[model samples]
Target chain A: MSLFAVQLRREWLLLVQSSEEILNPLVFLFLAITLFALATGGGPDTLQAIAPAVIWVLVLLANLLSLEGLFRRDFEDGTLEQLLLKAEPAFLALTAKILVHWTFSGLAMTVLAAVAALILYLPVSSLGTLLISLLVGTPALSLIGAVGAALTVGLKRGGVLLALLVLPLYVPVLIFGAGAVLEQMAGIETRAQIYWLGVISMASLTLAPFAVQAALRVSLEQ
Target chain B: MSMSASLSVSQSLKAWWHKLGSPRWFYEISGPWQRLFGVLALVLLVTGTVWGLAFAPQDYQQGNSFRIMYVHVPTAIVSQSVYMLMGAAGLVLLVWRMKLADMVLSAAVPFGMSMTACALFTGAVWGKPTWGAWWVWDARTTSMLVLLFLYFGLYALRQAIPREETAGRACAVLALVGTVNIPIIKYSVNWWLTLHQPASFTLTGAPSMPPSMWVPLLINVLGIYCLFAANLIGRLKLTILERERNTQWVRALVREVSA
Candidate 1:
C-alpha cells in the first residue's frame, strides 16, 4: 500500500480500536444538549425556538473537547516527529491526520446533533437539514480546531487556550450551520446556507492543513 | 551581459537596504519621524475633537449623540486596519524572517484590542439613545466583538508560547489565518444580523452631515491615523531598544541619553 493509504488505515484502526476516544464527545454533546434544555426551563416552545443555535454551539464545544488530544498522544510518544520526518511533502500526512480526526469526532458529533435536535424539539422537517448542515460544517470545525491543536500541543496549559484560538474561527461555520436549520424551520429555502457550508468546508479542507503544518513545525521546534 | 549588470545593481541595492534593517538605524531614523507625527497627531486630535464636540451642528435626528461618531468611527477604522497591518507584517516576518516586523506586530495587538474596545463601548453608548438599548447584536457591533476576540486570541497565543521566535512564527500564521476570517466574520455577521433583525440597523447611512459636520470627522480620521502611526513607531522604538539592548550601539545610545 502507498504510505498515505497505510497512514489512513492505521489511523482509522486506532480510532476504532479505542472506543472511548469516539464515545467521549458524543456523551459530552448529549449532556450539553440536556443541560441547555434544563437551563432554559425545558419548555417545548423555548427548546424549539433556540434548538438550532443550541445544537450548533454545543456541537462546537464538543468538537473542541475532541480536538484537545488530536496531536497530544502523537507528540508525547515521538510518533509525531516520525510522522513529520517520514512524509515527503508532510502536507498529505498532516491532512490525513485531520481527516481521521473528522471521521472520529466531527462525524460522530453530527449523528449526536441529529439525535439532540429531535430531543430538543426541533421541527421534524428540520432534522434532515440539521443533519446535512452538521455533516458539512463539522469537518471544517475539526480542520480549524486541528490547527489550534497543532499550535498549542507543546504548551502545558492548552485546553482553554485551544478554545480561544479555535472558536473565533468557528464563528462563520456556526452562523451558517445554524442558519441552514433555522431556514428550514422558517420554511425558507435552505440552499444558500448549505452552499456556503460546502464552500467553507472546501476552503478549510484546502487551506487549513498548511496552517496546521506550520503550527506543528513551530511547536516541535520549540 | 545585461542580466549580470542588473544582478550586481540589485545586489548593491539590497546591501544598502540591509543596513537600514538594523534596529539601531530604525531607532535613529524613526526618532524625527515619530516627533513629527506626535505633534501632528496631538494638534489634529485636539483641533478636531474640540470642533466636533463643541462647534459642529447637532444632527436633526440623532441630536448631540451623533457627535460621538468623531471618536467611534475613527477608532473603528484604525482597529480593522491595524489587524490588516499585523497580517501584512506577519507575511514579511514569515517570508523574510524580519525581527522588526514581529516587533511591530507585538506592539500593535494591545493597541488594536483597545481600539476595538473603544469602538464597541462607543457603539453601545451611541446605541443607547438611538436604538433604545445599550446593546444590539447588529451586524457592525457583533462583528466588532468577533474582531476583539480575534485580537485576544492572537495575543494569548503569542504569550502562551515560551520562546520568542517560535511565538512570533506561530502568531504570524494565526494572524494570517485570522485575516482571511475577518471578511468572512464580517459578511457572516452581517448576514446573520439582517436575517434575524430585518431592519436597517446602520447608523451612518446617509452622507447628510454637510462638510461642516463631516470635515471635523475627516480631521479626526486623519488625526487617528497619525496617532496610530505615532503610537506604533513609539512602541516599535522601545521594542527595538529592548531587543537590541545587548548590542554596543544601543548601549552607547543608552549611555548618551542617560549622560
Candidate 2:
C-alpha cells in the first residue's frame, strides 16, 4: 500500500511538472473541435448529428496523442529498468502511472467534452449522458493505451505504431460511449450503454495492467 | 492392467511433450506430417473448390455470386481459428519458452493475415452482388478488418525489434492481448449488425442445407484447415532451419540433405 502511495506521488510529481505535455493535448482538443466546426460550416443539426461521434473520436484521439509518449521519458532515463528490478509487482507502479496519465488526458477530455458539446451546438439535454459516458469510458482507454505504450517503449519512434497497435481495441469503448450519446440524442434511455461502458472501464482497469506489466518487461529487456 | 496401461500412456505423453519442445526433435519428427498434410491439402482443396464452384446449384436468391461463400466462410473460420492457434502458441511460448511454439506463432501470422484479406475480399465481392455496395458496416467485415489490423500490428512489431528472443516475447504478450479482443469483436459486431440490419443473409436459409450446397462448403472448410496446417508446418520447418542454422543438428541435417 505504501509502495502504491509512493508510486502515485511520483507520478503526480511528473504529471504536474510536465505542463507542456498536459497543454498540448488540450490545445489539440480545442483545435480539432474548432476545425471540425469550421469544416461543417456550423450547421446546428449536422453538428448535433455528428457531435456524439465527433466528440468521442476527438477525445479518443487526444487521449491517444497524449499517451503516445507516456513512458518514453521513464524508459530513456533507466527509471523503468530500476523500477522493474524492484521486488514488488511492476503493475502497481504501472497502474499509478496510467492513472496519472488518464487524469491528464481522459479525465481532462471528459470535462472538455461538454464545452465541445456546446461548441458543436449539441442539445443541452444530451450533455449529461455525453459527460457520463466519457467519464466511464476513458479509463479503459488509458488502461489499454498504457499496454500499447509499454509494448512500444523500446521503439525509437512508436507514436504512429502505438496508435495502430491500440486503436482497434478502443472500438468497444467508442461504440458504447458514442452509442450512449446517440441514444440520449435519439430519446432512448441510455442506461444500458452507460452500464456497458462502466463494465469496460472496470474490466480494462483490472486486466490491462497485467498486459502492460509483461509488455514493459519485454521492452526493458530489449 | 488398466492402471499400468494408463501409467504408460501418461509417461509417453510427457515424453512427447518434452520432445516437441525441442526444435531439433520437432524438425526430425515433423517431416512426415509436413508432406502428408501438404498432399492432403492440395488434393482436398482442388476437389472442394472445383466442386463448390461448378457443381453446386445456383442459390435461388444470390445466383452464382453466392458461390463466394465457399471462399469467404472457410477463410473467415480459418482466420479466427488461426488467431486462436497463435494465441495458444503464444501461451506455450511464454509459459514453456519453447522455440517450436514461437516458431508456429510467428510463422502462422502472415497466413492468418492473408486469410483475413481473402475473407474481406470475398465478403466485399459477395456484398456487391447481394448487399448492393462494395462495403457495409456489418459487424463481421468490420471485425475482420480489425483482425487484419491486429495481425499487421503483431507482424510489424515482430519486425521492429532487433533480437529474435525479445521480438518473440513481445509478440507473445501482444498476441495474447489481441486474443482478448477477438471475442469482444465477435459479440460487438453481432450486436451491431443485429441492431443495424436485422436478418442478413445466411449460408442456407433453410433449416438444414441440402448436401449439394453444404457438402462442398464443408469440404472447402476442412480443406482450408488442412492447407493452413500444411502452410504452418512448412513455415515452422523453415523458421527452425534459419534459427537453428548454427546448431550441429541443423548442420548435420543440411549435410544429410546435400548428400
Candidate 3:
C-alpha cells in the first residue's frame, strides 16, 4: 500500500482505539441542541424558526471541541514533528490526520445535526437541506479549525485562545451553511448558498492544509 | 542603452532593499521621514477637521450629521488598508524571513486595531442620528465588528506565544489566514440587507459629494495615512531598539541620547 494510504489507516485505527474521539462531539451537539431548545422555551414555532441557525452554531462548537485535541496527542508524543519530517511525500500525513479528524468531528456532527434538527422541530422538508449543508460545510470547519489547532498545539493554555482564533474564521461557513437550510425552509432558491458553501469547503480544502503545515512547523519549532 | 539603464535601476533597487534590512540603516534614514510625516499628519488633520466640520456644505438630506464622514471614512479606509499592509508584511516574513517585516507586522496591529475601533465608534455615532439606532447589524457594521474580532485574535495569539520569533511567525500565519478570510467575510456579510450607504468615492467616477465636501475627506484620508505611517515608524523604531538592545549600535545610540 502507498504510504499515504498507510497513514490514513494508521490514523483511523488510532481514532477507533479511542472511540470517544468520534463520540464526544456527537454527544456535545445533541446536548447543546437540547439545551437550546430548553433555553428558548421549547416552543415548536420558535424552535422551527431558529432551528437551522441553532444547529449550525452547535455543530460549529462541537467541531471546535473536537479540534482542541486534533494534534495534541501526536504533538505531546513528538510524533507530529517526525510525521512532518518523514511522511514520504510532504503533507500526506498531515492531510491524513485532518481527514481522520473530519471523519471523527465533521462527519459525525453531520449525522448528529440531523437528529438535533429533528429535535428542534425542523420541518421535514428542510431535513435533507440541513444534512446536505452540514455534510458539505463541516469539513471546511474542520480544515480551518485544524489550522488553529496546529498554531496553538505548542501552547500550555490553548483552549479559549483556540476558540477566539477560529470562530471569526468560521463566520462565513456558518453564514452559508445555515443560510442554505434557512433558505430552503423559506421556499427560496438555496442553490447559491449551497454553491458558496461548496466553494468555501473547496477553498479551505486546498488552502488550509498549507496554513496548517506552516502553523505546525511554527508550533514544533518552539 | 535602455537595457543598461534598466539594469542599473534594478541594481540600485536591489541595493536599497538590502540597506533596509539593516535596523540601524532604517533607524537613521527614517528619522527625517518620520518627522516629515508627523508634521504633515498634524497640519493636514487640523485643516481637514476645520474645513469638514465648519465650512463644508451640509448634506441636502442628512444635514450636518453627514460631516461625521470626515472622521469615519478616513479611519475606516485606514483600518482596512493597515490589515492589508500587515498581511503583505506577513507574506514577506514567511517567505523571505525578513526581521524588519515582522517588526512592521507587530507595529501595525495595535494601530490598526485602534483605527478599526475608531471607525466602528465613529460609525455608531453617525448611525444614531441617521439610522435611529446606536448599532445595527448592517453588512458594513457587522463585518467591521468581525474585523475587530480578527484583530483581537491576532493580538491574543501574539500574547500567548512567549518566544518572540515564534510568536512573530505564528502571527504571520494567522495574519495570512485572516487575509484570505476577510473577503469571504465581506461577501457573506453583504448577503444581509444593507442600510449603510454605498461608498461616496469611486476611483472611476467623480466624488458623489461636491469637492467642497470630498476635498476635506481627501485631506483627512491623506492625513490619516501619514499619521499611520508615523505611528508605524515610531513603534517599529522602538521595537528595533528593544529587540536589538544587546547590540552595539543600540547601546551607542542609547548612550548618545543619554549624554
Candidate 4:
C-alpha cells in the first residue's frame, strides 16, 4: 500500500488500541443531554423548542473535548516529529489523522445526537435536517479544531487554551448548523443554512490542513 | 532606458520595504512620528469632540444621545481596522520571518482589545437610550462581540506559549486563520439579523446625514486613526527596546539617555 494508506492504518490502530479516546466524548454527549433534560424537568414542549440548540452546543463542546487528545498523544510519543521529518509532505499524514479524528468524535457524536435528540423531544421531522447539518458541519469543526490542537499540542497545559483559540472560529458553524434545524422545525426553507455550512466545510477542508501543518512546524521548532 | 528606470524603481521599493522590516531602523525613525501623531491626535480629537458634542445640532430623533456617535463610530471603525493591521503583520511574519512584524502583531493586540471594548461599551450606552436595552443580539453588535473574542483568543494564545518566537509564529497562524474567517463570520451574522443602522458614510456615496454631522464624525475618525498609529509606534518601540536590551546599541542608547 501507499504511504497515506500506511499512515491511515497506523492512526486507526492507535485509536482502536486506546478506545477510551472515542468513548470520552461520546459519554460526555450522552450525559450532558440527559442532564439537560433532568435539569429542565424533562418537559417535552420546552425541550423540543431548545433541542436543536442544546444538541448542537453539546456536540461542539464534545468535539472540543476530543480535540485535547487529538495531537497530544502523538506529540508525546514523538510520532508527530517523525511524521513531519519524512521526505514526503505532511499534509497527507495530517489529513489521515484529522479524518480518523472526525470519524471517531464527530461521526460518533452525530449518531449519538440522533439519540440525544429523541431524548430531548426534537420533532421527528427535524431529525433529518439535524443529521444532515451535523454531517456537513462537523468535518469543518474537526478541521478547525485540528488547527488549534496542532498549535497547542506542544504546550504542557494546552486544553483550555485550545478551546479559547478554536471557539471563535466555531461560531459560524454553530450558527448555521443549529440554525438549519431550527428553521426546518419552524417550517422555513433551510437550504441557505445548509448551503453555507457546506461552503464552510469545503473551505476548511481545503485551507485548514495547510494551517495545521504550519502550526505543527511552529510547535516543533520550540 | 525606460526599462532600466522601471527596474530601478522596483528595486528601490523593495529596498524601502526591507528597511522597514528592521526593528532598529524602525526604532530610530519612529520617534518624531510618534510625537507628531500624538500632537495631531490631541488637536483633532479635542476639536472634534467639542464640535460634535456641543456645536453640532442635536438629533431631532435621539436628542443629545446622538453625540455618543462621535465616540462609538470611530472606535468601532478603528477596532476592525486594527485587526486587519495585525492580520497583515501576521502574513509578513509567516511569509518573510520578519521579527518586526511579530512585534507589530503583539503590540497592537492590547490597543485593539481596548478599542473593541470601548466600542462595545459605547455601543451599549448608546443602545440604552435608543434601543431601550443595554445589549441586543443585533448583527453588528454580535459580530463586534465575536471580534472581541477573537482578540482575546490571540492574547491568550500569546500568553500560553513560553518561547517568544514560537508564540509569535503560532499567533501568526491563528491571526491568519481568524482573518480568513472574518469575512465569513460577518456575512453569516449579517444573514442572521441586521437591526443596526446602515453605515453613515460610504465610499461610493455622499454622506447620508448632513455635512454638519458627518464633518465632525470624519474629524473624530481621523483623530482616532492617529491615536492608534501613535499608540502602536510607542508600544512597538518599547517592545524593540525590551527585546534588544542585551544588544550594544540599546545599552549605549540607554546610557546616552540616562547620562
State every prediction's TM-score relative to the real structure: 0.96, 0.96, 0.95, 0.96
For model 2, residues A1-88, the per-residue Cα lDDT tens digits are 7878899999889889989999899899889988988998989988989999999998888888998779989899999888888939
In candidate 3, the residue pairs with backbone N, CA or C atoms under 3 Å apart (3 or more residues apart, or in different chains) clash, namely none
Q: Each predicted model: what fraction of the native A–B Cα contacts (within 8 Å) does it retain?
A: 0.86, 0.64, 0.82, 0.82
Q: Which residue pairs clash in candidate 2?
A: none
The sequence of per-residue lDDT tens digits that candidate 4 reaches over residues A1-222 is 377798889899999999899998899988998899899998899999999999999999999999989988878888899999982778888988899999999888888888888888899999999999999999999999999999999998998989988998999999999889988998998988898999999999899999999999999888
How well is each residue in A154-191 modelled by candidate 3, as lDDT tens digits? 99999999999999999999988888888798788887
Two-way lDDT contest, 1 vs 2, winner: 1
Candidate 3 lDDT, tens digit per residue, B73-98?
89998999998898898998999898
Which residue pairs in model 4 clash with each other? Answer: none
Model 2, C-alpha of B146: deviation from truth (Å): 0.9
Worst 10 residues of 2 chain B by lDDT: B195-204
lDDT, candidate 4, residue B17? 90
Model 1: which docking level applies? high
Residue runs of model 1 more than 4 Å from their true location after superposition? B1-9
| Interface RMSD to the true structure, each candidate | 0.7, 1.0, 0.7, 0.6
Which structure among the candidates has the greatest lDDT?
4
lDDT of 2 by residue, B177-221 (tens): 889878876676665565557665553455766799889888888
iRMS, candidate 1, in Å: value is 0.7
Model 3 TM-score? 0.95
Better of 1 and 3 by DockQ: 1
